[model samples]
Target: MTTAPAPPSLPAHQQPGAPVPLRAVGPPRLRALDGLRLLAALMVAAYHYGGRDGEISDAWGGSPTHQFPTASQFFAYGCLGVQIFFVISGFVICMSGWGRPLRAFFASRVSRLFPAYWAAVILVTAVFALPWVAYEAVSPTDALTNLTMLQMPLGVDRVLGVCWTLWAEMRFYALFALCVVLPGATRGRVVMFCAGWTLAAVVAEAANNSVLDIVLMPEYAPFFIGGIGFYLIHRYGPRDTTGWAIVAVSWLLGQHYAVTRLWHAADLPNAFSYRSSFGIIAVVTVGHLLVAAVALGKLRWANWRWLTVAGALTYPFYLIHEHLGWVTVHWLHVTLGLPAAATLPLTVTLMLALAWCLYRFIERPLTPRLKRSLMG
Candidate 1:
């Protein structure tokens, strides 16, 4: 992966007017990781509505397809990308909190995550609630829940519509913060928590409808726990190809099962039969391992300067493209009438352009300023 920019060499006893050399701090930059983020963002964007009629068909039989295997099945499996994000989040967040006090860790996380999210939520709600749009008006309770990032626990859907993942992330942050605060908690604590959370997910699934159901859903906490495990392994475990092999095998098995089942069940009206338990564990484990392999791998050509930049902008892209609204997709469908084959490429290109512009003009400059203000 691409290493961070090197600090300039400075001579000792330089003149007072001499420019000082900047020093690199924290962990070295990982370009491949950013590339992975770019891939995830693209997968999510394409999966949203980048096909004919702007809908990726589920196994429940939503639409007709020209081919024996449709693109929607691929997209359905692609939702694993979000789980990938959760794992990455766990690793990155823990690294950030390593050796830090709980207050500082919490502050840093809140500062990084909440500002952009709050802005997006406000902007989306305002745009959609316009009288001309005729979108459903969000109730006060919904707005409050979103603002507090507690909508998942409250059983209210995201006000920003695409922010359901944020609920999971916020919960993960809480659990992680607790780990940081505890006096005797080692890396093992993180593993135990993850295992416990995974078990809780299975129990919640079995129970069907209860408070535990919300907490233990694979979509909610398991991936985050997996990420924590990944961090522990990276920090303490031996670096070898064995981990990579296990990751690859798990990924293929999980992906194959999900795809085959979805494809076979496509004609069924209620195609939600595939269980999430196996897929969740497999994907989360594989996703982190893939990332770790790339980060620690010995590939000399893995570094790409631009990929790091793209990764930094990935979050903004995700936030923007996901909230473009059904109307945007409808407009494109009516105006262009593009076939499914053309939809994925076209939408991805457009979304990337928009995301890049937003990053360049808005998010990039603000991120450093916000960090300085918050951290300094």
Candidate 2:
């Protein structure tokens, strides 16, 4: 999201049976997470626009931008930002549900995700994709499937491709929702859930079924678990040393799994000696460190409140960026004859501005109304 994860923590005064609404739960927002959200969004943008030869040029009548300087491996590695998002989501979800009722947890998640997301979906489908049917011949079935954001696990396609992350987020929510269902049983349920899912992933790998691997998405589960461990440490502090050890192990597994998954995308394993490059390692390392720092209160200054805006823009930017920015890049570079230098930064700026507008006009305004309608 610029994932707009649920706010972390609950006020000490909030009682379990008090009927407090999720949004009304008085947790002081963790502002560092907001800044973290912004950073992850930028990484994904870099992945789409600057990765490899620059996926932007794929739209124009030319090859990837060899001429553009920043359009190098830096951008290519940015796709791992999605992994960072997954981990952050785990932290957000855990923190949001920490002391709240089960239903409140679900409601908070819905309010945070759906308002901005639904707005982005309608805009992208109607304004952009529908107009291209003459060439693309879109299927109504595929179109309808993505609206649920359940498409991937349901074996359907996403209306917006970047929305693939939502599918994973949804899965994480589905699994983590167990953590709240029975109140007293929440942690036990979550531990069992993660273990079962992780085992399923192992069996899928053993069976050598690529499809099954994608279906379970176990590789990403470690990141989510790591996030959970982080919440334990942040909330319980040094008393949760076991949580820290678990998180450390989970991070290692998550990074290893991430490299294997990313290599396939980059079409690696050509020689088999060393599959991943430095960029892959850096993305994994830096993302993990950032979360660790936040959990340990190392980035306490990030809680300054203003950074919330950056965090807020992340989701909309992520949703609209790939397709819209790609189209804009094509138009600017090919039609307007702009160079990559101008086109890339312009695309980023325009998308960022649009993301802010979405937050300002669509997200912030609709959030309360949507919460009342959907959660109330």
Candidate 3:
């Protein structure tokens, strides 16, 4: 699931030679980003429901191509939503982390990530443990390890497949915290970090080094790097050439990596075979363009009041949607004799309701207390 805190106040742009300060009244909440995040989460849910591989198909008792047909063709590309999320993450992280101390930054991250995550791990584990559910449940030890969000490095399977993205976000946060936040995230330092990460990712891929690939995340580094660049442009002004250059280079590289990765996945026996690599490339391009538009302030009109609530549901919705949604689909469509049309909407409604409860009841009460404890 894509997750990050709200953007913090930002210092305004300075004269070319003047030093930039750390704090000032920043722009209004990018409700548009919240809206974009919700859309991304929905896209991912759509993919898992009808466009993924044999799991959803197995649950539904029919091939996705035969079952979803036209919709599957579109939803097949929804995995690209994660790319969109990474880009948003970079932008939000840079915005939030700017001018904050390392302790405050670290505290905010822990508070934001763990409240819902711990709950989701236990909840998804319990759901999978139901006797009627077909999805295999992980051992209690793995589930406990998952609570720390270190399961990826520890060689444990994720309780929810979407947790993998949370792991990626964690790694990005670590790199940012040490390299940027710990030292202080000034404009120059942030730009340098982005450039350095982009270069290292390239080297890691060229050398085929497993360790560097894991650390650098060549496939996803561009999106996060580009997001930092966008935040810089948003903070400094549109005339920031260095920021624009970083974004431009990142967009070019992001497309290449995305297409290459998707193409490689084409051979996977259990995964959805994409219809066209070119189509995948186009979708990735669109994802970059959308974030770029937000950076340029073109989407400011999308700042509707309800989007804040929409954003609140995104993370939890993503967390529970995969394993739990699939199981519900199996029970509803296959066992209950409901049609796909009715079953899909009903399942989504139920998931959204659960996400809201997770947010309103659990996240709302726990976040500030957790942050205060960590801060202390």
Best candidate, lDDT: 3
lDDT of each: 0.57, 0.71, 0.86
Residue-wise lDDT of candidate 3 within 177-213, one digit each (tens)?
9999999877778878998999999999999998998
Supply the global lDDT for candidate 2: 0.71
lDDT of 2 by residue, 1-376 (tens): 2833332454432322223344443447788998998899888887777664434556655545464444555566778888899889888887776556666667777877887788777766665555642224236687666666777767765557787788788777866666444353234444455556667766887888877766667678788888877766666454455557657877787878887766653454432122255557677878888998888889887677678878888899999998787778877887799988898889989998999999999888888876677656
lDDT of 3 at 133: 82
Which pairs, if any, clash in model 1? 2-303
Candidate 1 lDDT at 370 equals 69
Tens digits of per-residue lDDT, candidate 1, 169-230, equal 77677766775544323444544555566566657766876676555554345445545555
Q: Predict model 1's lDDT versus the native.
A: 0.57
Which ranges in model 1 have alpha carbons more than 4 Å from their true place? Answer: 1-26, 50-69, 130-145, 181-185, 188-209, 215-220, 237-267, 270-289, 298-300, 336-343, 365-376
List candidate 3 segments past 4 Å from native: 1-18, 264-271
In the order shown, the candidates' Cα RMSDs to the true structure are 9.2, 7.2, 5.9
Residue 84: error of model 2 in Å? Answer: 0.6
How close is every model to the real structure, measured as TM-score?
Answer: 0.70, 0.82, 0.93
Task: Single out the weakest 10-residue window by summed lDDT for candidate 3.
Answer: 9-18
